[model samples]
Target: MVCVKNLSFRLQKIILNDITLSIEPKGQIIALLGPNGSGKTTLMNVLADLYQKYEGNVHDVGKVQLLPDYAYIPEDLTIRECFNLFGQVYDTFNIEKAIQIFSYLNLNQDQLISSYSKGMKEQLHLAFLLCHDVDTYLLDEPLAAVDPLTRDILIDLIMKFKTNSGVTIISTHLIQDMDKLFDEVIFMSNGKILLHNSVPQLFEKYPGLSLDDIYKEVNRNVPFN
Candidate 1:
């Protein structure tokens, strides 16, 4: 489990404010839903320790009890090299999974990262993440650049990946097609959490509304800053 208290961050001005939440690595997928520049990526970066200037207390319950490694797959990287780099870094890296994902994606190990199209690179990045056996995963708009077919495949793979014991947080603006995969959803607007609830609870509050519909209603009158 991970505990976050009074978390906040800023660039030239405030981006995330007073965010507090607890996450458990119980094979559950969580969605960070928001518009662009709504601080979803910022929060994910902070949690991944990619940004240094943030005020908060993030505590992981098990220190020596569990592996200390985590995986964060950015949008760009050399596919083959990334696999080798992660394999070197993580002792528990699963090469078999890597082969399976690569074969499924039809990615050539010898191809340069710069050679692949945007969609192909995104698929490769996800494949790299699956190759590693980590406790925490922070995927930032992973499906944003993929084609329809690739998006469907990646989403299915993510669901399969979440069947293990790890905390997977997927930040996305495309909610309708993928919302069903989330056990819980965190809606953010202008850097603050608007609502957080289970899928059933959210639908209960707004009857007959799809995730996208509820999201539209949430930020209906609010203006982005």
Candidate 2:
């Protein structure tokens, strides 16, 4: 479980206001939806321990694995080498499972990361993260550059992880493709949370509205500073 109580951050006098959220330790996927600069990435970074110079408290209740937006896979290293490096960093590294994920994502282990396509690199990064057995996975825009077919594959991979073990927190603007993927949705503006509810609850309250529609409606009226 991850809990943020009155978390706040400031940059150049622009404040990311108090935010409090609690994530349960169950087989659930949470999506953080907001426009660019809406503090989705900032909040994810804080939760991932990438930024510590913020007010309030961030409580990480279990082992956490973070996949940032520009998640770095050394361009000079081969896919296998990258896996080996991550294996050394994490205590529970499963090389066999990594290979399986690579195969599932149609990634070539022998190729250098620089030689791989953007989508393939994303897949490889996800595979590398999955090798570690962590309780929570924070993914930022996992499908940003992925092709349509690969997007489905990546979504399947994420769902498989959630089904097998661990909870996932995905921060992305691709709401249409995420309707069936998320158990809960969190809407944000600037640095403040505007809405947070279960998928079913949201739909029940606003009938005939898609996630994208809700996003547009929320951001249209509420201008983020």
The top-ranked prediction according to lDDT is 2
lDDT of 1 by residue, 83-165 (tens): 77777777867787887777777777767777777766666667676666667777787787667788988898888664367
lDDT of 2 by residue, 12-124 (tens): 86456899988776778888998888888888778778888999998864677788878587899988887788788777677888877777777677888898778877877
TM-score of 1: 0.84
Give the range of the ten consecutive residues with the poorest summed lDDT in model 1.
61-70
User: After aligning candidate 2 to the native by TM-score, how far in Å is the CA of 175 from where it should be?
Assistant: 0.9
Q: Residue 105, candidate 2: how far off, in angstroms? A: 3.0
lDDT of each: 0.75, 0.80
lDDT of 1 at 54: 89
User: Stretches of candidate 2 above 4 Å error?
Assistant: 163-165
Per-residue error at 73 for model 2, in Å?
Answer: 0.9
Question: Against the hidden reference, what TM-scores do the models get?
Answer: 0.84, 0.91
